[model samples]
Target: MRGPLVLACLTLLGAEASAQEVVKIGHVAPLSGPQASFGKDNENGARMAVEDLNAQGVTIGGKKIKLELVAEDDAADPKQGTAAAQKLCDAKVNGVVGHLNSGTTIPAAKIYNKCGVPQVTPSATNPELTQLGYKTVFRLLANDNALGAGLANHAAKQLKLKRIAIIDDRTAYGTGIAEVFKKTALANGVEIVDQQATNDKATDFMSILTAIKGKKPDGIFFGGMGPQAGPMLRQMQQLGLGKVYLFGGDGVCTAELPKLAANVKTIENVVCAVGGAALDKRAQGVEWKKRYDAKYPGQFQIYSAYAYDATMVLVDAMKRAKSTNPAVYAAKLFDTDYEGVSAHVQFEPNGELKNPAMTLYVYRGGVRVSTN
Candidate 1:
């Protein structure tokens, strides 16, 4: 499902600003497939931030300013992602807020860097994205290295699962995190029974499970999107894969996973890891949900809050820099420290989170509960 999209109409509304230079923000992410909910959720959050900032008459250099979003669909494809970035560059947008998948975000990073458009990703976790020495690309979320190490440590020191099998979706983020998990797990004396590969769009997992079952692994580690993970969970359950846990990277943090797993029989015990804000129904999160529900009902997805924060951050930097020129605003971004829905957010010199933190989650009785 594509979910509810607050589609960006690309209209220019800078009348109140004395500067009269319209600032355009570009957003490109997956708006289709199993991860569609996530991309749409982020788009909604960005739209809210843009609307909020534009309504405030935010001024720069004695000129009122308007923040406008120009949205594009990456379709979770790297080529499409590069195309989207190029389109934004061609249009001369001020900045960007997306490229959700690391595989897509990584290649698109070079394009954004080449065009000098600062792009901050909300959810891509591959560490190599920032390791490329491209200052134009930033990741607000924690990287896969942290996530893989966290889960690996937990499995080895806490859960003490001796026999582990690792699997990857073959994407950049997937492979990177899985390799980290493998090395960490091995370092902790956990035996690597099997390692497998799967594609992001794969639905049939019987052969993989067949191979893994033969090895008698205590647990399975997957580094892929929730669409594939949910089905794999169902297959494992149906195949009588007992006492085996399913762990994955942030690629599995979709709201639709539970429902997807439920549709297939024999999927109950499943665990997942996520890399973004897990609002605990607090008043702040509740209020955000209420606003989102009022605007777009039953269409919530992961990383929306991050996307919102990213958009607001760019707008804030633009207002501070007092110019829509990409060069000036890009420089001013380094000077920003804003309190966003995600956290008091800022970036380090490497474009990673200043204090990178992650949260672990599990599906309990059909609801995602944060276990810290």
Candidate 2:
């Protein structure tokens, strides 16, 4: 009787183990480059979602589901981004949640689409990303269209600047935003005094600033990231352009901007636009940020909340579809109406966020403060 009872318990344990399914979600970002801070923050958000989902003991298709995050480092390179995407597809991850920059995300989107893997980008804002017509690609926030135009409108109407110089890193994101800002600023009767170009990895802007200084522009609009923006700010001060207003898109909008700028006084002159409402303004955002800070401390930059929402959005689709298979659940993303920490997650036919919000911010006393 004792031998029979022991055998029965063993058989039941084996059945329980077989009834559980493991789901892998891939997260790709520039985890080892100048943008690593932003990448880490993005990864942290997705990881937190995975942890929370597991804690809730989620089930799909009547089987217990264990979520796993498989992160990849694209180093902010387009080629590496494609490689990372292919690797995830080969690994057969159920979903994807990153490739933080537009340069990386655009190329990676093709690979994910080809493999039929659904990808949600939390931070990449290039309009062309969704324009590719890939059904598997989705954006979690407003695109460069909103961010660039918003900043241009503020510069021309709110700040009432007359002449502005433009500088872009020349990546897809940088160039796209810079062009929109230029066109909008010109239409608003603001003069584009000078136009210059730079690469994302460049650190020195002394020569460019020296040239633009001669133009006597009232402001400078830069389309790039915080790492380049920081050194450019210092160079601007060194070249006696400290009093000039500095306008930028979401690429330059980050909590680390002050630190990256080495606490420069020029930071106070910066006005940048981000693609979401101010996190501190909403009840849901406020609470979500509190939980994130407790878990991640000072690592918060700009896109963590969006990344968290993206991860949750993916899981919501899986749960609704009752399956973790990409082919089975990919279509469910287009129908997503999940309430997320960032916003009520919904998508247009082109995979762009529906009714997205944009916020402007500035640095005061070395801290990021929202202007809207």
Candidate 3:
């Protein structure tokens, strides 16, 4: 009886091993530096998607497929991002789901495109990203044109601000949104009193704040991520600019924003636009956020859902084309219209999300809540 049981166990193990085929998906983000929190959140989202896909026993080409996530940290730098992209290409990942910043995504995109691996960016909202004509590149968010214009419209129509100052971190993501915002604001009859620049890693904003304060602007538009935005807010409070409305794009619209600022007054004055519908308002988003929160705990950031959706979109394309080969199924990505946690994931000819939703948010009692 013991010998028979041993033989059966060996047969089951052999069957399990023979039935599974592994597919690698690459994810890149700033897993180190000031943006580590965002990177970790994005990686967790990808990991969750891979786990869920495997649990469902996903099959491709009549073979059971096991999805694996290969995460890399670009530190939000363009060169490092390209290196990571090259590494992923060398490793022969079937698809990719990240490089969170536009600065990183745009450069890394060329590498992925050169290698014929499909790359989907979950965040990176620069309009130029899609304009690069890379057939393998797709974005799952509204571009800077949408976010910047939306914020400018809200500022002009609702807030009725006359004079505005702008500050950017000078990265591709930062300068791109600032340029759009400036253009939109100027067209809307708002005066551009001052323009300033800062690096993403800079903590000292007093020099720029002092100049902007001298200009007596009614509002300040910051083009950067939450790490810079947080400290900038604190410095604004110190410089007596707390009452002035602080506006930014999706870069600053994180749950971590208020905590980073630690100045409830300054945070309360912040209005940021995110390139997606508010999770609480969408039925699918609400349910998805619940599951995400359950698994990730208090680590929910803006792009996690997008990252999850991007991963799903890649897998969906593979399933539809019935192949995991990047070249074989990448074209199928163009025809996708899957209902994801974020939205109906469809793309235009330029690889931009079709009818992408944009939402404005503000801090209400120290919590970042959507105003849209």
Top candidate on lDDT is 2
For candidate 2, give the lDDT.
Answer: 0.94
Tell me the lDDT of model 3 at 8.
95
Candidate lDDT values, in order: 0.81, 0.94, 0.93
lDDT for each residue of candidate 3 in 120-189, tens digit (9 for 90 to 100): 9999999998898999999998999999999999999899999999999999999999999999999999
Model 3 regions lying over 4 Å from their true place: 1-9
Residue 256, candidate 2: C-alpha displacement in angstroms: 1.3
lDDT of 2 at 342: 87
Candidate 2 residues lying further than 4 Å off, grouped into runs, are 1-7
What tens-digit string does per-residue lDDT give for candidate 1 at 1-372? 333342222222333334455678899889987678778888998888888887876777666666788999999999899999899999999899998889899999999899899998988889999899987877777898888988888888878799989889999988999999999999999999999999988999999999999998888889888888888888888888857877877778666678878644333445556665566634566677778778978777678878888888887777787776778888777776987767667888878878766778777667667777
Q: lDDT tens digits, residues 288-372, model 2?
A: 9999999999999999999999999999999999999999999999999988888888999999999999999999999899988
How many pairs collide in each candidate, listed in order?
Answer: 0, 0, 0
Which 10-residue span in candidate 3 carries the lowest summed lDDT?
256-265
In angstroms, what RMSD does candidate 1 have relative to the true structure?
7.1
